[model samples]
Target: MDNVITVRDLRVLDGRKTLVGPVTFELPGGSTTGLCGPSGAGKSTVLRALVDLLPHGLTRDGDVEVQGQAIRYGKGDSALRSTVVLVPQTPVVFGGSILDNALFGLRHLVRASRAEMRDRVEQALREAGLWNEVSGRLDSPAQALSNGQRQRLCLARALALEPAALLLDEPTSALDERSRDTVEESVAALRGNRTVLLVSHDPAQVQRLCDRTVSLEHPETLALSAAAA
Candidate 1:
C-alpha cells in the first residue's frame, strides 16, 4: 500500500536541546496508525511538527513526506496543512451555527456554490458519524453540542477538506467514558477509508483502533541508550 505520510529521523528541538524524536513511522493509505508513549514523550509535538504548527521558539529536524512529496523543514505552508489536517486534543468551537462550524475549514480552502458546500458538509458529517444526529438541526448554535459532538464536529471540519491524512492528537482524552466511546466509534468508522495517525496514551485504545503502532521512548530512556552506546 502507498503511504499517506512518511517520517524519518524526525526530531523536535528547543534552542540547542532535543525535545523529541529521532522518531520514524509511516501511515499507509486508508490505514489507522497509533503513536503512543508516556507523558512528556512528545507524541503531540511530532504531530505539530508535521504540519509546521510547532509553538514559537521551537523547530523540527528530519524528513517528512506527504503523498510522496518532501516537506522541507520550516517551509510547510498553508497548502501543506490543508492536505494533512490536524485535529487537536481540545475541541475548538466557533461562535456560529453548527453548519458554519462544519464549514469553517472548508470556507477558507475551497470555493464552491452554496449547494456544493452543503453537500460536502453533509458528506463530512456523515463520515465523522455526526450527520444523523445534526441533520435536522444544521442551524442550531454550535455551542449546544456536547463535548463528544464538538470533537466530532472538529473531525468533520477537517474531513470536509478531504485531506490526504489526519493527525489526531489524543482525540478522546478529555471526554467521559460514554463520550470517549462515541468518538472512538467515529474514528473506527474511518478505517479503510481515511488515513489516520492517532496519538494516545492509552495502550488499549491503540490496540483497539490502530493497525500498527509506533512507540516512543521517554527522553530519559533515549538518553540512557545514547550514553550506553
Candidate 2:
C-alpha cells in the first residue's frame, strides 16, 4: 500500500512541556490506523498537530506530509483542508436542516450542482447509516437528531467532501455503548477506500478496528531513546 500520510521527527511543545515525541510513523492509503494511550498521553495533541490545530503559542517541529505533499502549517492553506478532514470528539452541527447540514461542505465547490449535491448528500447519509433514521426528516433541524445521529451526520458532512483522509479524535467517546458500536461499524466500513487515523483510548476499539497501533509516551523519553539510538 502507498503511504497517505507521514510524520517524520514530529514534535509539539506547549511552553516548557513537551506534548508529544519526535515521533515517526506512516499511515498507508486506504487503511485505518489507531492511536491509543491514556489521557494526557498526547493522542489528541497529535491529531491537532496533524490538522494544524495546535493550541496558541505551541510550537511544532519536524514534518507532516499528506498525499506526498508537505503540510504548510499556519498558512491558512486550503489544500490541507480540502484533502484532509478532521472530525473532533465533539460534533459541530450548524443551525440548519439535516439536508442543509449534509450539503454544507460541498456548497462552495464549482463542479457540484444542486442536483448532484442533493444526490451526494442522500448517498452519503445512507452510507453513514443515517438515511433510514433521517430520510423522513430532511427538513428538520439538525440539532433535533439524537447524539448518535448527530455524530453520523458529521461523518456524512466529511464524506460529502470526498477527502483523501479522515482524522477522527475519540469519535466514539461521547456515545453510549450501542452508539459506539454503530460508529465503529461505520468506521470499519470506511476502510480500504479512505485513509483513516483514529485517536482513541479504548483498547478494545483499537484491537477491533485498526491494523496497527501507535502509542506515544512522554516527549523526554522519546528524545532519550532517539539520542541513545
Candidate 3:
C-alpha cells in the first residue's frame, strides 16, 4: 500500500468545544512521519483518537482509515489497536520477568506453541535493539532494566504484534539524554521498515528521526468557523 493511514478533518471535542483539530494527514507505507506542535495542541490526544482510546467524556469526529479501511469513531477498539499500536511517553513494564513482559501482548494476539512464541519475542527484542543486552537475562525481573531498556522493551512488545502502523507519543521524552539517543537509534532503524507517526515537542529530534512532518497549530489558532464546518 502506498499509504498505510489516511486522516482527514480530524477533531477532538469536549462537549462541543473543539479541543484539537480539523487536522489532516496521510502516512505513506514504511515512512516515519512526525506529528508535532507546542503544548496544548493535542498532539497526544490525536493519537488516542486514532485508536478510539480517547478519555471519558471526550469524543472525536473525523475520517481515519487504516490500510484503506475506515474506522468509525468510538468503534475501533482492541482490533484496531492491534493493527495500529500506540506506544505512550512513559515506559510501562508489567510486573513479571523480562520474558513475560516481552510476550505480554503477543500471547493474546497470536496462537502458537511455546517455542514459536519465544522465537517471536526474540525477533522483536532484536528489532528493538535490545536482544544483545538482555539475551542472557531473559528470565530476570523486568523492573531491573534501566529506563532506556524499559522503553525499548516496550517497543519490542509493540513490535512483536507486527502492527501495520505505530503511533509513538513522545517515546523518549521521559528518558535521560543517553537513553534518548539509544531510543532514537532504535526508531531510526525502523525508518524504511515500519510506518510510524511520532508525536514530539522537539523539532530538532523530529528533524533527526522523521522522513517528513505534519505540524499542528495551537488549538486556539484554528478558526471557529472552520471547526464548526
Candidate 4:
C-alpha cells in the first residue's frame, strides 16, 4: 500500500517553547492507524500541523508530504487540506438541514447541479453510516439530530470530499458507550478502503480500530517516538 501522508521529524513550537514532536510517521493508503499518547503530547497539534493549521505563534519544521507532494506552509495553503481532511473532535453543525450540512464544504469545492450534489451527499452519508438513519429525514434541521448523529454528519461531510487521508481527532471521546460503539462501527467499516489516522485516549478503541499504532512522546523525552507506525 502507498502512503498518503508522510512526516519526517515534524515539530511544533510556540515561540521558544517546544510544544510537540520531532514526531514522524506515515499513513498507509487503505488502512487505519491509531495515534495515542499521554495528554499534552501534541497528538492533535500534529494533525493541525499536517494541514498547515497550527495555532497562533506556533511554527513547525521538518517535512510533511501528501500524496508525494510536499505541503507548502506559507500562504495558508488549504489546497492540501482539501485533499487530506481533518475531522476535529467537536462536531460543528451550521444553520441548515442535515443534507445541507453534509453538502456544505463539498459544494464549495466542486461545481455540480443539485441532483448531482444530492447523489454525492447520499454516497457520503452511506459511507459515514448515517444514510439509513437520516435518509428519510435529510430535510430535518441539523440541530435536532443527536450528538452522535451530528458527529457522523461531520464525518459524512468529510467523506463527501473523497479525501486522500482522514485525520480523525478523538472521534468518539465525548460520546456515551452506545454512541461510541456506533461510531466505532462506522470507522471500522472504512478499513482497507480509506486511510484513517484516529487519535484516541482509549487504548482498547485504538487496538480494535487500528491496524498499527503510533505513539507520540512528550517533548521533554530524550527522543521522539520511534514506533514504525
Q: Estimate each model's TM-score.
A: 0.92, 0.89, 0.92, 0.92
Residue 191 local lDDT, model 2:
70
C-alpha lDDT of residue 35 in model 4: 82
Candidate with more favorable, higher TM-score: 2 or 3: 3
How close to the true structure is residue 96 of candidate 4, measured as C-alpha lDDT?
87
Q: lDDT value for candidate 1?
A: 0.88
- How high is the CA lDDT of each candidate model? 0.88, 0.81, 0.88, 0.85
List clashing residue pairs in candidate 3. Answer: none
Candidates sorted on TM-score, descending: 1, 4, 3, 2
- After TM-score superposition, what is the CA distance of residue 10 in candidate 4 from its true location, in Å? 0.3
Per-residue lDDT of model 2, residues 62-173, tens digit only = 9988888888788987667767888889888999899988988788542577998888888888778889998998999999987888899999988887888899999999
Give candidate 4 misplaced runs (Cα > 4 Å). Answer: 218-229
Instruction: Give the range of the ten consecutive residues with the poorest summed lDDT in model 2.
Output: 220-229
Candidate 3 lDDT over 109-224, as tens digits, reads: 77778998898899989999999999999999999999999999999999988899999999999999999999999999998899998999987888788877787873222211
